[model samples]
Target: MSWQYVLELIQNILISQTGIPHMTWGHGIMLLIALFFLYLAVAKGFEPLLLLPIGFGIFLVNFPIVPLMGLNAEGHMNLIEYFYQYGVASEIIPCVIFLGLGAMTDFGPLIANPKMLIIGAGAQLGVFVTYVGVLFFGFTLKEAASVGIIGGADGPTTIYLTAKLAPHLLGANALAAYSYMAMVPLIQPPIMRLMTTPEQRRIKMRQLRPVSAREKLLFPLIGCALIVLLIPMVAPLMGMFMFGNFMRESMMVKRLSDTAQNSLMNIVTIFLGLSVGATMQAEVFLNWKPLLIFGFGLLDFVVCTFGGILTVHIMNLFLKEKINPLIGSAGVSAVPMSARVSHVEGLKADPNNWLMMHAMAPNLAGVIGSAAAAGMMIAMFQ
Candidate 1:
């Protein structure tokens, strides 16, 4: 071959071998964002289970000319695409995660105080509010519903609903849901403080009644039947959630419960985090919709936090033995995190005040409430 032709071939191979020639500013920006997420997950230990894998997924998919997602030339999907399709799009992974959550969760507090269910339902105000708000932004009903669940602060429900309703926005919605969830400690306290007075925070709650094993076992069965009957669309998520809880409470299936809580949960979490992160490909994520989703997500969390506290205030006006409004803030479904925040704030006001069990009631309720909201939204699409 001629030297000139050989040099041209060498240049072409060099260009083809590396992503640098094809990388754009969007890719650069997204890579930096992924790195930041990694820093948060690794350095700051912020939601490391989800964030670390998600950050790495973003890093992988953003590389130019890659086929980390989508179909290849032969029309078959790559590895991550398969993971996304079956794990998320098929809606199996989220349900599995719920099973794990149920296995790990202690629903005794919620069983002891059924009234907390109202606070959970009340926190869903942000879901509907954001649903209406996103309509003005030109998102269709399904898309709006998917985006609004970010307010409920339940990441799996958000993903499951988004996958069913608006798969196109899955990457953005999942990222937004999880990112906001990680920041619950920061996002909730301000609104919680602003809405409640010193007296409300200092209000000492009565000790939660010790729940019987029978009540614990019956809760998932009755709760599942009631919720599913009311909102069947949530059957998969709720059914799995209750089943896991049942396994834990049943006392006959200790081995299964342990596997669900530890081994199975850990496996699904890794898949979920990686697939979710892979969705943040630069072209799909670096758009106005993601920004809008992020903005709406923040608003949803704020409004939900407000709604929970407001529900508490409204309830206190009527109840003889009042609840501390701070516990209501835990109704946003960030699970133990939001509940812990409420407990910390309560301690700040009164060192003797212990609201963990009380806050747990609403926190557990928030899980059901978010799943119900998801069901309602999914019904709209159906």
Candidate 2:
């Protein structure tokens, strides 16, 4: 071959062999943002397991010339987009995550205090309230619904509903969902304090009535049927949640159930984190939408927290017994974080009162209620 031709061929090969391609100002900025998240995750201990990987993924995808995210003219999808299309868009990831969540969760608290279900429903006020906020921002109904879902405080439910309705906003929505989750300690305490006085916060909760194994056994099956029949669109998310819980409760598939709750979940979480971070490439991350998404998410969390507190207060007016309003803060649906914060806040008010079990009632209810709300968004959009 001629020397010139040989040199040209070598250059092409090098370009193709290395993941690096090009760089831009936007990518550089995203790299910094990614590092910020990493710092928060590592030093601050803010959702480290999730945020650390997410920050790393963002860094990898934004690096100069890296083909990790497939942003070239050829437009071949990288691993992130592949999962986004097959698992996320197809609505598989959320359901799988739910399966894992169900395996990890204990429904004893919720089942024991079924009356707490109302607080869970009330907590969903943020979803609808934020829907109006998004609408005012000029988003169409579908987009508004997508933004509003950040209030649900459940990551899988956010993804599940957004994938079904507004696929383009998935990255922003996912980030919002997780970011708000990490902020539960910061977001909930002020609201919890503001919503109730010292006396109310000091009120101790009654010990939960024992829930029979029979009640636990029937709950998943009946809840599955009830939620799905009522809102068929939400069935995928809700059904998976119930099915996983049933597998755990029934004692029939101990091995499968254990795998779902532990091994499978860890594996999926890694993939989900990396994939989500990859989507946060600079051009995508540095936008007004992300800010709006984050803001709406915070607003949603605040709304849910107070909604639960107020609901408990209202319920107390008619009922003979009074429920501690602090427990209502757990209705934000961030699993144990909101519940833990509720517990910690309660201890600060009164060291003698242990409200962990009480908060759990609303915490678990938020999970189901969020899924139900997500399902409603899906149905309306579909």
Best by TM-score: 1
All candidates: TM-score: 0.97, 0.92
What digit string (tens of lDDT, one per residue) describes model 2 on residues 29-138? Answer: 89888899889889988787678877888888887666576545687776667766676768887899998888777899998889999999999999999999988887
Task: State the lDDT of candidate 1 residue by residue for 92-195, as single tens digits.
Answer: 99999999999998999999999999999999999999999999999998999999999999989999999999998987888888889989999999999999
lDDT agreement with native, every candidate:
0.93, 0.84
lDDT of 2: 0.84
Model 2: how far residue 163 lies from native, Å: 1.8
> Against the true structure, whose lDDT is highest?
1
Worst 10 residues of 2 by lDDT: 64-73
The runs of at least 3 residues in candidate 1 whose Cα sits more than 4 Å from the true structure, single-residue gaps closed, are: none
